[model samples]
Target: MSNLTIVLIILVIYMALMVLIGLQGRKHSSNMQDFLTAGKQGTLLLVTGSYMGSHIGNGIVVGGAEYGATYGIGGMWYGVGAAISFYLFAIFMARVVYRNNYVTLSDLLEQRYGDKMTSIAVALLNAVSNIAVMAGQIMAGERLFQYIGLNPLAGAIATTTIVIIYSSLSGLWGVMMTDVIQVTVIVISVIATMIFIATQGGFSIMAQNLPATSFEMIPFDGETFIMMLGPTALFGLVSSTGFQRTVSCKKEKTAILAPVLGASLILLFVPLPVMIGMYGKALWPDAASGTIIFQVLFEAMPPLLAGLLIASICAAVMSTSDGILVTVTANIVSDIYHKHINPDADEKSLGRLSRISSVVIGIFALIIALQFSSLISLLSLSYTLITAGGLVMIVGAIFWKKATRQGALASFIAGVACVVINKMGVSLPYASVFPLIPSFLAYVIVSLMTQNKNAAAA
Candidate 1:
């Protein structure tokens, strides 16, 4: 059979398996709570698998490889940053969020900030950012398909349809169960590919063929560190998806431990993609960075193995797309629709709304994916907005007792404004850092003013 034929068969089989998993998961997801959090019954294994599955999406796989091609071993910083974020989530945010019985990140904001507006703002921000994240996954899947002789648009539609089906069917249960399967495939495929590389001449050959600058752990310039590393590390602390995983755990300790464990495992897999990218750099230095992973997989592995690896790539993309689709739907239904549109929305109505919202948001994400081609750039922009606008408020709400509603709102506005200004061709010292200063200042100043006024009024 032709390589394309083999890949197409494998793809069909993999997708069918996902449908079966989704059908099985549907049994457990009968209400809003089940749809959103899998009834919060996730064991450590389930939580860890799902968390790792969602976080290490197409962005990490393709982006990490691209960075590896450009920056050599140092490209592992992206994964390292992600790992650190999960650790921070485990240590600081997990137990507190669990103890408070918060269903969503916005729930914490609503309870602490005492404002419907703040919750709505956060819901909207998270919805936009997560859709961008989902778009990155779709873009990656599209690229994977294009590399294998399929039309990119058709590929994106097919990928998006599969994600919507599984996600809309069983919600978090489907997402988590499929995650378990996806992560296993990801781990095995990466390891096999890495071992293949080792048998065929190894890192010394790759290192000899690449530039020394690619291997630098940290750039010589401090500004590079601030620009490249800072925002990514901080993004972990405030990721809505990460927060969702924490809240989904059945036990507080499990919530805390799962991410840390997951992070460690993810750290181990980071090197595999980086090595593949370096190999791509060694072989096809002029090829587009986004296509390097596909080139490496197809060139290095046999037809069947390459097909399996490609399926794993689809797994990575689908796992994250489904998770984000559900998250965006939850924000719409729980945070906005339930809170404002119909406060008395019953469980059945909410459940139906959640599924419908998934399809709507999935279509929007597919549109965005088609519009944007660069996965890393889209992800970076989304991460910046989420970190700048959401992080301070989340931190203050959890740790700072005096953090006022006015303060949180001010911080969010200031942060978003700074990011917008920077994006609109205004040069800043560091795009991520410049916005944070005003955001922090706004929070502190507004909180103190509001607190003192309340005291005087009393």
Candidate 2:
């Protein structure tokens, strides 16, 4: 078969397998817990694979490669930061979250704060932010199809339909299982592509050809460096997704190992695409840096190998979109539907609602993905929303015995409001500081003040 034909075949087979897995997972997921958290029976390897695969999606895959071209040796810090975030999760947050028995982060928050208002708000924003992420995945898949001389929109629609159909059927089990397969394909392909490029010129030639800024540790302005490393790290560590992964793990060791292993692999290879892009830039300076990966594989590499590499990129996007679909649906069904509308709803009814929610959320995300442009910008915004409300509420629940419902309520409202206002560009110019800082402070102050009142009454 031709290279294009090979790629098309791989995608068809892979997508077909995912749909089958989705159908099979339904057997295991007969209840809300089964659908949302796999009956809390996720094994160590399962947790590791799912968390690692989901976090290192298409953006990290292709985007890391793009950064490798520009950021040089230092750009690997992105994965480095991510690894650190997971490490912190394993040490402090994972066990606590798991012990709490909350299905979603919003579920935990609502219980502590005694408020549904913030949970409602969080569910809405989580769905919206996740759509932003799904859109980027769609865009990446589209770019790949474009290189093969197919319509970008058609590629996007096809990819989205497959993901949504499977996700609607399988829920979290399907997402986690499929992620392992996707991550394997992505890693193997990335390594193969990198080795090929390295052999063509070696690091010496690549370094000699690429610009100096591409290799520097602190590529951006001094302020940008601090912003990226400081609050960004905190935001990532404390967010709902990170906590959920930690809580989802079968054991603490699994939580620790998966992220470390995944992060290490990502750090080792993600820069390869950038190096490829750098080489492409040297060869075709006018080529858009964003398009460098697709352009290089299509034009430089032999057809058979290029098809394999492109399949890897598709794996990256699908792995992530499915996981996010599961997470968002869990929040809606557990935190919104079951919690407020019908606490006594049967497991069968909740399971059916979860499947329905998955499809509804998938469509909404596809629509938004069609509209957005920048992947990193949307990622930053989503993290901000989660950190602002989610981080503080989770921390308070675990650490502070004195943290009252009133205090939790205040923190939830103020943190979310501040995050939204900051994100909407309503604050002073350059006042768009990371939301975690202010949200953390509000949580601390409110909790302390309320604790003192309770003590006085005693």
State the lDDT of candidate 2 residue by residue for 1-458, as single tens digits: 67667767876666676678778788756766666676555676666767667656665666655555555655455555555566666667666666775566677667766668767766766666677667767777766766677887787887787677766677677777777777777677767777877787756666677677876777776544543344345554555555556566677666556666655565665555556666776666666655667787777777666766676567657767877777787778777787788999987787678768767876776676667555544555555556566666677777777776656656667767876686576763332245556666777787787887767765
- Misplaced by over 4 Å in model 1 are 219-224, 455-458
Candidate 1 lDDT over 306-417, as tens digits, reads 7787887787688788889888987999889998899998988887887788888989999999987666667767878888898899898988998888899999999999
Candidate 2 wrongly placed segments (more than 4 Å): 202-205, 226-232, 239-248, 252-257, 426-433, 452-458
lDDT of 1: 0.81
- Model 1 sits at a Cα RMSD from the real structure of 1.8
- The alpha-carbon deviation from the true structure for residue 346 of candidate 1, after best TM-score superposition, in angstroms, is 2.5
How many steric overlaps are in each model, in order? 0, 6
Per-residue error (Å), model 2, residue 1: 5.4
Lowest summed lDDT window (length 10), candidate 2: 428-437
Question: What's the TM-score of every candidate structure?
Answer: 0.95, 0.88
Looking at model 2, the pairs that clash are: 65-274, 69-274, 70-214, 71-214, 72-214, 135-369
Q: Please give the range of 10 consecutive residues that has the lowest summed lDDT in model 1.
A: 219-228
